[model samples]
Target: MRSIPSHHRLILAVLAGACLALASPAIGQEAEDGLEIGDAPAIMPVDPSDAGEIERGARPSSSTGDANRLDRGERDSAPPVTKGDKPMVGGEPDALQGINIYLRMGTPLPDVPPEKPYEGEPDTAYGAFQRGLFLTAVDRALPRAQLGDPAAQTLLAEIMSRGLGVKRDLKGAAFWYGQAAQGGDPAAMFKYALLLMEGKEVPQDREKADDYMRRAADAGNASAQFNWAQILVAGTPGVRGLTAAMPYYEKAAEQGIADAQYALAQVYSALKDVPAEKKARAREWMTRAARAGFDTAQLDMGLWLVNGYNGPRDYEAGYRWLSIAAARGNVVAQNRLAHLYINALGTAPDPIEAAKWYVLSRRAGLKDPGLEDFYLGLTEEQQKQAIDRANRFRRT
Candidate 1:
């Protein structure tokens, strides 16, 4: 009899690399009316061990000390906003509060998942590449490539472009990529489009690039879909652009491109015209991206969880997510974490912890006058403790 391992446990083990604790994100918001939190435990130390588990792919143990401590998702509960409480991003009646993913989307564009690993030695050119016999890979690929084999052509292009056991030749790579693209290889189409856009390797052709990108995107290439969405949004900025790009983003997101997932979260959460069902899915996508190690998504996920945006708020889960992001050295999370510490929104009020986070964010060059005022109001001894904590803080 074959024994099946627990699937949920296995999934968590796989996702542990993303620092996922599986804290419940859908806990209902608790009221803030005279909330009695003075008796709550002080900001508990974030489990430093989870970071270590990320690389080892270990199953995360639940928060320690179950006797007196409240369950994680129920501790801070959720949205604690009262009559005068402000939204996290701080804008007027209607404004985009989610951290803008556009800020860094260009520099290191989202990459597609690499080709699936080989099970055993196959007589393919890629088998040679995988075995570190790059020269043999090129030798085996060239004749098949010449015979109009798209996969072989694509492999030859990759080897040439990357200079794997051969003199690098962008022009030659571009030619092979174009040949494979013409033969309807999705990956080749994408690579060729990039070369067309770069102009250094090939003559800059925006129209040609768009055509190839669109072709690759339609062929279900995940990176192509994400880049196509970006292209559409870049062509027309604002709500209209986002709305137009939604389909591409959704497709790419479903294919597990974290950037597209983050983009979907932003547009779905922001737009009033978005269906309630789709809007509710915003946090779901954001959480996936967050668990994929998109630090910005983690920061936004914390904010979304805390504010009950797109889903029920879960302040305890949000705090933990923020802690994860802060540990990852996200300056924005550090700033927001400081607020959570000071206000007792998730953890018990701890001015020293609050000031520690503020110092970290300040060192990262984010200026927050209100946090500054709060810092100045702290006692000298408290300030020293905060500074010391910040100095000793090393991202795990």
Candidate 2:
């Protein structure tokens, strides 16, 4: 048996969370809940050394976490509120309250064995991880798991892998995950493959990893499908690129997988031999992902909207979406918003607004040449003022 490298352990952690930790739009009600993007919760990083802890759901809470992420969907135009054009009312904000965004219809709390009935909501492993409440979720459910409940198996595996209330143990975790995978859980399939590849407390096998990935992708695991497409597109020498990959990507994109939608959009946009109709379809995909709150998609979609690519220009709409994206801590959107604000084109220019957004963009890791120029253009006193403003914003 090959030893799984430490890096592969990290991959396993990512794969495990990838299935359940999809970023969905914040579903919220209309109130003054500050939707400041960077202020949102952080997605836990994949940790190789702490694979056992993370794999079992032992997540340490940061002040910020990506609890309220969004996904792509056919958006009904913002409903007419009596207050007129205001920020988005529902979706992402509601998600913060522990509601699943893009709640797919399914039987809530599937049948667990007699020993495991009524553990809790079966839809998420996050709350346990966040509040350090792993044991409460696990102990209450393990009896049912021992009695052959698939949901219990899945939850137990998550607890084992993430180290929620228990000490981390990869091999034991894989056993539970395997039980869930055998019961036809798509999420388990992806996690199983991650473990196989990592060889973390399990035997390493690339062929097995590929098989699990294929199974997960076939089962409509959007992240798995997108990643499989990436593997195929990259052409791993002996593994020939499969034409079969395209439909998988399309399926995932249709499910509002932002990465796939973005890739599909790019493919169509750059196709020289494609007909106008094909280009139109590509733009549609871009539009789909953009509205889902993926930053790259938002930036690309905003650009297309501004340029009237495959449609008429809608600068106001473009600005609105772009502003939303920038607010979400997307550096690209920040830079674009800054420039748009600076130019005062379409919307009135406010240098202070531009400066505020620019500071946000900087925090998002954008190194805009124009921002440096903007800074230099300001008087020494103004530069000090901007610094103070940025610091104050951070403290808030």
TM-score of each: 0.67, 0.56
**Against the hidden true structure, what lDDT does model 2 obtain?**
0.58
Local lDDT at 220 for model 1:
93
- Quantify all predictions' global Cα lDDT against the true fold: 0.70, 0.58
Cα-based lDDT at residue 346, candidate 1: 79
Candidate 2 segments exceeding 4 Å error: 1-156, 162-169, 179-185, 236-244, 272-278, 359-371, 394-396
Report the number of clashing residue pairs per model. 0, 36
Off by over 4 Å in 1: 1-123
Give lDDT tens digits, candidate 1, residues 230-308.
6666565566667787898899899998777877777776666889999878888999989988776788789888988
After aligning candidate 1 to the native by TM-score, how far in Å is the CA of 131 from where it should be? Answer: 3.7
What is candidate 1's CA lDDT for residue 322? 91
Q: Write the per-residue lDDT of candidate 2 for residues 1-396, one digit (tens) a residue.
A: 113233111222222122123322121111111111111111112233432233233334542343222211234234533221123445433223333333344334445467746876654434454444465566555666667766667777877776655677666677777767667678877777666655545566666566667778899888778766654544321112323345666777888776677666765554355467766797789778777655656766776676676567877777877776766655666677777778865578877667777876677566778787896787777667666766665311
Judged by whole-model lDDT over C-alpha atoms, candidate 1 comes out at 0.70
> Number of the top candidate by lDDT?
1
